[model samples]
Target: MPYSNIILDMKGICKTFPGVVALSNVDFQLKKGEIHTLMGENGAGKSTLIKVLTGVYQIDDGEIVLNGKEIRITSTGEAQKYGISTVYQEVNLCPNLTVAENIYIGREPMKNHSIDWETINKNAEKLLDLRLNLKIDVKKLLSSYSVAIQQLVAIARAVDISKGILILDEPTSSLDSNEVKELFKAMRKLKDEGMSIVFVTHFLDQVYEISDRITVLRNGKFIGTYEAKKLLRIDLISKMVGKEFNNIESIIKKSRDISFKASEVNFVKATKFGKRGTIEPFDIDIKQGEILGFAGLLGSGRTEVAKLIFGIDKADHGTIKIRSKEYSYIYPLKAIKEGFGFCPEDRKVQGIIGELSIRENIILALQSSMGIFKYLPMKKQEEISEKYVELLKIVTPSIEQRIDNLSGGNQQKVILARWLATNPQLLILDEPTRGIDVGAKSEVMKLVAKLASAGMTIIFISSELQEMVRCCDRIFVLRDRMIIRELIGDEIQEKNIMETIAQGGISYGKN
Candidate 1:
């Protein structure tokens, strides 16, 4: 096949923050009518590069060429004028406004020097019609629609400007399989029309499904770009993480096996714990020295279940029992006091306090659990920090080091350390190993097993089926806001989990 025409090119791009090289001598090119995927672990400079390209950040070094001409993008407005637009993971639209208004907020059609609602709606519908496969009411308020629809509206808006490059950053993270298929169809249609798309995501399956070419970045450096069809999934992961993906089963199998010893103690039990239109009420039980895995597809209510259990979101109808005592409307603070700790999925937003030091972050949960007036002694704080620094193998110059300065793996470890310092009897980890390197991933899994073996009950969520099968003593399969199946003992296998998820219902059997 003939090489595609180059649409966008960057040469020797470099960006740096205080004491950190975010991107170093990175080169990238996008071809017309092709979906180019940017692959990397978190903090591998993927976000930095995207920000630089979209004028969110000024590149310290590099030249950008668009359509065979050099261009300098100084601001978001300027970038948009030069035919470049970005749709971030979070939908950047006014929730209270109508879909049509959100799509053409500042660029609405005018009639007699006034906003023209009819013309605006017509134009917005045209754009949506050209891009998306489904029909959306242009007059409906954005918040009334589901997340998938809102995401589609965002993409429709981004592509409406006509001659620009569109960048989609992790757009499918929250979308279900059917929604993802719809998004892919739209993307392929856009590619066929000569639009250059830069797709950024952590889902390996998606990269292979939609990308024409794949570009790998590791620790701020460009590894190489290859045709998507020629790249194996394992090879792609190895390149992005700069190491071979470990055999999770082998690692877990080699570790000392801990038999399940039933006890009268029930760490957590929730009956009908769910919010309307969010997650269905589900009952779960965890015993000491057990790692209970929540297995599900995207938007299958795994995170929602964890959130309800952790009190991040209040359950509208349900009863939760901790150690045989019922909790009525328990919040996070109350949960913490009851020896419950939660590590959220989105680490950057919910997990880390970027402004705090490693010691401060580690001590946060403990401090809260201890109450505000009860300050932790400095010596005690140091002792606790040092212990977890060794236990979780957190890498830092000192406990005094700023949490933001550490690498992604180390930062994740620090988050884990934060909860561990709380001395929780039951810990809930939501996508704990996401966006980290292979070595760090294995370390985190081993830490989880260790914690369980020491009689700390744990509930973990992972999108990787193999991980759930390996690390969890029992797996609860969720689909569309309900637990459909529970696999225990020898039934907890990768094939079983995948088949259950594919079948899209609940099944249960005791070992």
Candidate 2:
């Protein structure tokens, strides 16, 4: 297990923004031919470290050594020149273009002043067959294949172009179990052939499965590095969160005190609510002033149910009633009109408008819900933004500043503030604390509990079993787009929820 060579070494790295010190004196080491994992909670500087190495950011301090020599990467092209390539979660490729064109688009060979289609396709096919062992028509449009295939094509593109380091940033976020295996297969193939890989993901199972080493960071500071086999999973999580990993019972017991079961007239009732070909028909009643949680695997239909409720996806069947207001089909506008607010899973894509100011974004939901003509005064907007900014402790220079400049945690708080401004009867939060620090997650969960106590209904969704057990009064167990079980009372525990998800299937009638 001795590492013969250190292919890349980052020493005393530091990165900072206006109010946030992203990384401080952090050191990362990547061994030649070894798959190294950058482990931490969201905002743990995992992405920052990768960015500094990949020329996405100019380092404030420290040095980068590659292949026993110093190197300065100023841009993506320069990073590629040093044989450092990256494939982010969202593949930076055109779906409308052919697979071959996507693979060699910028680096295509010119034949008589035109792109040589024959050479591009032939080389792409060779790379797919030889290295990835993939058998597919390179001439086909990239969108014709699944996300997993596109992920592989992305990796194939990187592998064909670079020889030094390949960074995969949460590449399996959208892939199913089978697709993840295929990705791991390709990663293993690369590792065996002496390609150093930097993998950043929140999934623990994938960590032990694919990584040779893991470097832990906390609050933008390097904690330690350990071999994959040497570190225990619980200990690793503890290090990342900067807390002990033995408080499940205490957390659940605390959740029990904030109860809504004493008096419930059913806040919202869905009768056979379903989206055809998306989620199966199901019935459930969410109580007033209660935290309802959805528990499942990556594609176990957790997000789908939230979408159906928030009207992001229209339901083909069933009826929904919010506080006795009935609707045959629920969509976002109707849901919002009838007192519903949604914080989507993908914060970057769907939640916040980056170009807008904090003041503008905060009043968006309320403004939209009140109709466009019911304009909020500029003074009123500043007052609301300033109030929530202080309440949620959003780190921003001023309310008029653009939202894109803030950190992930601050941005999440802004979205929460936006929804709270609407004062909706029910809130649906999907992965509300996915990529933030442990402190921010605690704050968000506490806020959810406080809001529910203040008579706001919440449907919480998260992949963390511990968080689900700790926050939810009742959990709906989903699998394959169906609510298999509605867990309450003693069934709401980490062990039970996991077991229910792994051992049970969708077999119950509409509940």
Highest-TM-score candidate:
2
Worst 10 residues of 1 by lDDT: 247-256
Best-matching candidate per lDDT: 2
The lowest-lDDT stretch of 10 consecutive residues in candidate 2 is 254-263
Report every candidate's CA lDDT: 0.83, 0.85
Candidate 2: the clashing residue pairs are none
TM-score of model number 1: 0.69
Tell me the tens digit of each residue's lDDT in model 2 across 1-511. 5455899989999999888899999999999889999888656888889899889998999899988898888998899999999999898899999999999988999999998999999999999888787889999999999888999999999998887689999898777678889899888888888888999886666788898999998879999999999987657766775655354453355444444442477878888988765677889888888889998755567888889888888888998887878877777888888889999888899999999999999999989888878899999999999999999999988999999999899999999999999888899999999888899999998898788777788999987778888778889988656788888877787656655654555544564
- lDDT, residue 210, candidate 2: 92
- TM-score, per-candidate, Cα-based: 0.69, 0.74
| Model 1 residue pairs with clashes | 484-506, 484-507, 485-507
